[model samples]
Target: MDKTAGEYHFTRLETVVFGAGKVESLGRELSRRGSNRALIVTGKTLGRSKLLDKVKSAAGSALAGVFTGAEQHVPSHTVNELVAEARRVGADSMVSFGGGSPIDTVKNAAWQLMGGRAGSRTIDFSAGAAESGRGGDILHIAIPTTLSAGEFTPGGGVTNESTKVKGGVADPRLQAKVVILDPALTIETPAWLWASTGMRALDHAVEGSYSTRHQLVTDTLATKAIELLNAHLLPSLQMHGDDELEHRMRCQLAAWLSIFGMSNTRGGISHALGHQIGPMWNVPHGVTSCITLPHVMRFMAEVAADRFGPIAQGFDLRFDPRSPRSSAVECADRIAKFIGKFEVPTRLRDVGVPREEISRIAGTVLEEVKRANTVGVEVTLEQLVGILDAAY
Candidate 1:
């Protein structure tokens, strides 16, 4: 087949194990690879949960030490601390057993440990290290419990606390060698988190559809992800007992498909804003998506109407005899309603983004995009502030 206009690339993870009880295979898998000491990187909540115990049991003697300080936004200082501990313990491998934060932290630590320049040093996204092509040799496993699907991609987002800008390395070596998707482990996740992260996945699918660098294969996966999320996310949110394994699994699958095209393209304004606002406001990635995505669609209606068509169809939206732009605006409305169904906040104010910071946030978005070498979508400070104002 003739390829799309732009180039594309994807990472085929070395191994992916899905299904209940599959997390139990971690120890043997490490042993098979001759890994003797593996560090566990995760957030505080998951570290205290019985799930960590389960991961520890599975890791057996290979479990070296557990770093539970992987906070939201994956601060550069946190990465240095974790890297220090990893070296102190002489860990030979790493396991990221939580959501995006821990996974991103592990990605940075692994990169530093595997001979990247500036090992264990604070990362400055504005320093242009993220766009520099670099890879590491450390073996990392990602066992995700949320739908923020950072595990599937090579870019690891780390925030500098001093600057409050999120950025990190985008080396192929940062990709996880193994990903274990065991829904049983997710039962402990709060319904709000599960639903919110699903919205994050939705943001990925929607943005990928309109990204300038989007390719045929990525569009296909993003569309299917949209369909699956529309069909299953709500039911997954309403799941009562352990019997809803299939719903959870399908949501996880949707999250996977949502960002399956990461190696080729990057998200546009929604993601750029999310990465900035997340570290600034101390908001979760999912909440940022819930608030930013619909407004982004509305903002892009004039430029990317055709791109939103399949997404509108995925949401089962019916259109009248209106112009394509009008139909695209309706698609944005449909996304707002779909997210509203879960009772999450869809406005910036609702997420505690003060009105005064709108311009600052917009400026940060522009700077980060320029530094990261973002392609496809371009935004001026005025346009970004307008989107923020509308969301506000």
Candidate 2:
């Protein structure tokens, strides 16, 4: 019952409006933000959907143009192209629709439009500079279409095509100025992607809750996110078309809460490894998180057994507190089994990560020591290699 065992600061989106029919208010929100000329960003699939039509109709003349080239891993060239398009359209503000890729891209583009640089190379994590306003101003609004939960965070991930490394850009100014959470907008999301990303959100909550930097506030959000995701993700995936409203709303809420928790506490080994392997293998962020999460949990159990016990209980892993280590392993295994319910490939090789490349992947991940500052774990290179090997 010691709620304040950890102390930390919490931050979140400036304005969030969530509901079933909330997309109908898109134009009103844009106009209220003093954004008459808005650029809408989405993926190719979402661009061709009726949802895009809905957004266009809602925004009407306030919508300047649409950029549908958002891709997974957020390649640097894509960022530059989108930035050019945003400038070409003379957009005063941006609306990002779709998953983490589109959201992260627009967030970065907005930052660049506000004079931030598209990192010349892969992010140098050693340079932990605080982001300050550069005097250039362009507001950003996010309409997330999946539960990957990038919209609520102030960081964006972009891949350096030259090096084939994905890097993160952390800037408070990159946070969305307004977020409209319309579950209806998520109707177009494919089922596999939806469920896998929901598991990714659950990973965020789990990692954030037990993070060394976790605080009372973040713990509360993480707990709620866990409860919501456990209850809703499967149902959302199972009943996508039949029961759209409640299921999508729950997924949206879970995603938001996951990011809310993570924004404060940072994440753990799962994120650290996923951040490394995702871009290298062209894996989706959520899928990589799903594959690595349980293994990372098992690894973390040695140092964080006490924290794992409660999470085990929450997930209904029945075991005695005296045997916290066993219980923690059970918790990790149970999570892996739960993830299995979604039919996501649980092994790296299942997704085309060749066995021979394991060492190379591990080596690439070892280079991610820069993530240690934020990951809340002193993950050594040897330890990372072990994680990749175990996951393999």
Candidate 3:
């Protein structure tokens, strides 16, 4: 194997506060950002949790209002509604209080409200949009309570209700101004959600490692992320002993590392399919990964076997060193076992996705992949359907 130093750029939130109780620093962080009016965006469940109250107490009078209307897939209408809420509250800054949904909602809504672009839902990442001027100037503080790493990336997925297809947008401004990773805030997250989103983070690392633009640095982070998630996710889900917080924090760190250099690369078919299936079938991104990642890994194994070596090692899957394809298959097998251990649906049928919808999902994915050209592998309608068929 030939090795050469490759170039890649790393971008991240302006500030990141990571610890057990760093959520308490929200007010001071907001003040430091010169934000006086903050609107909290979250889902209904978290809205009612004492977690929101903790954020409220931290924000004090600086908290202008709260909007708990965030939903799965971030429907465009929701973004429009949240924009109205932001306007009504005169919120100078926003805090995303849930997982990917709320964080995505805040980024898209803020982008539109702050005069970036309306109807910019279909993110053409192939055009290098992340390096362009398309997002807003709105200040966003992301306090993620789940393992979804939406806060770390500028890409936001928004669903069109009428079409039931999710599109994405990428711009640097959509990246949160600050991100607070406090494991305490995640204590109330449902076990299934924590486990599923842990899969989502695992997907990020797996996909990032084999991304067409994968860099040495990003690959290193992605590999370590896989190790951390594989080691800690189950224990975190089991929530054993006083060290459970440490497990959660490590998972959070894994989530961050999973996408650390994603700005320079993009996830392959699993994510592409997830972006479309998420809105079409109303499945969460993590669930999409549960149904798709292993299948996609198998599909890509023929062409990208070498790329799976680190992931195989991360999972401690022993394979014949002479056959990279066998190693890749072992990697996929390990992922399936890991996902199954959580007792989550690892098949489309298990998730209630109609078998008939496979073609439609493939068609949609084909169009998006053709248009964006961001998928790492050469994808065709047949290949997409084949992947879906295997998942089914």
Candidate 4:
């Protein structure tokens, strides 16, 4: 297939290793990067996990200190603390050992270590564009325990404490030099959180495939990701003991592929809505994605109809392109039903989002995240309210 003009200009993570026990190689990987001093970053719960202890033991003398204060949304105060800890330990490098939150925290710390500033000043998404400039040297490694796929991208989300809003920091310098994907680490993840985040990864793949910026390369990756999630996500959620490994590995692969496509094509309304609602309600990022995903698909169905048929086929749904809108609607409804099988809440109210706050959430999205999306849909604040109302 002939490539679209300008679509070939893209950058991706340096190294990605995927397997059941690949995390055991982290010690040697860090050594290879010429780092003897490492700062381990993770959330409080994951910091205490045996998997993290194994990483610490594997690093042995190379591990300088463990900072266990990483939060759900990367708060500016937490970033300040993590950066100080990194400096206090005289750490030469860092490792993010959990899901999106820890990964995001570590990425922001890396950016700060490289001279990026953070303060009361809010990022204007409209004017903020990522540049390819190299910053100060600090090697970073990511070991993702959840399947949100933030480990695979050059962007990171950090919340401003004062305003309580999540803003993205996009810099190639924040990309992990080495990524270790071990399904073993995922076993300890809470089932609801795992399944919900897996759905978020699926959302990334689905939205990226239809993005106006998508190319053939991204489309292929997105299609395969959707297929893998279709075949494996539910089974993964229900597995126990030895059966868990294969399912988790498949979920990890799906997450990787989703971000591989998304980095090239970005995401659409689901993510934009999630970003809007997450900070306000303290909703889990994945839960936000899960609740809003189907609604976003229904809204975008008119323009994204051609892309929906492949997604339907991936899930073994009987698809007729002649009825693209209905086929897409079926795909969305199927996903919602699949998600309902888990402990995740299907409705906005189920997650504690009140009716009155819907418009406020819409306002935040229109003011913050919508500028970064290139969906060609021309979403207005009222349209966002309609989505929230429907989900509510």
Model 4 misplaced regions, further than 4 Å: 1-6, 119-129, 132-134, 318-323, 368-370
- Tell me the tens digit of each residue's lDDT in model 4 across 161-197: 7677777676766778888998888888998889899
Best by TM-score: 3
Decreasing lDDT order of the candidates = 3, 1, 4, 2
| Residue 39 of model 2, lDDT score | 90
Give lDDT per model, in order: 0.81, 0.77, 0.84, 0.79
Encode model 3's per-residue lDDT on 1-392: one tens digit a residue.
77786767545478889988899899999998889999999999998898899999988779999999999999888889999999998999999999999999998897787576656546455433345554337899999999989899877888878888777666776789899999988998888889889999999889887777787788888889999999999998776655899999999999999988777767678888898877888788888899999998888787778777668767877655578898898798889988999967788888788988778867767766666454555677888888889999
lDDT of 1 by residue, 1-392 (tens): 64546655656478888888899989988998788899999998998898899999999989998999898898888889999999999998899998899999998887788767533222233222133444436788999999999999876888877878776676767788889999988888888788889999998888877766676787788878989989888887676666477888888899999988855656677888888788888889899999999888898886767666557667767644346788889888888988999878788899888889877867768775554443445667888888888888
TM-score of each: 0.91, 0.92, 0.95, 0.94
**Candidate 2, 1-392: lDDT as tens digits:** 64445444434356888988788888888888788998999889998898899888988789899999999988887889999998898888889989999998987777677777776344432222345657554688888888888888777888888777777676666778788898888877888888889888988888876677666676677767777887878887677463867877987898888768565566676876787678888888789977899988888788776666446645756757677788878878888888988968788987898877766656546555444454445667788878888888
Which wins on lDDT, candidate 2 or candidate 4? 4
Clashes of 2: 0
Give each prediction's root-mean-square deviation over alpha carbons: 3.2, 2.6, 1.9, 2.3
Better of 3 and 4 by TM-score: 3
Q: For this target, which candidate reaches the highest lDDT against the unseen true structure?
A: 3
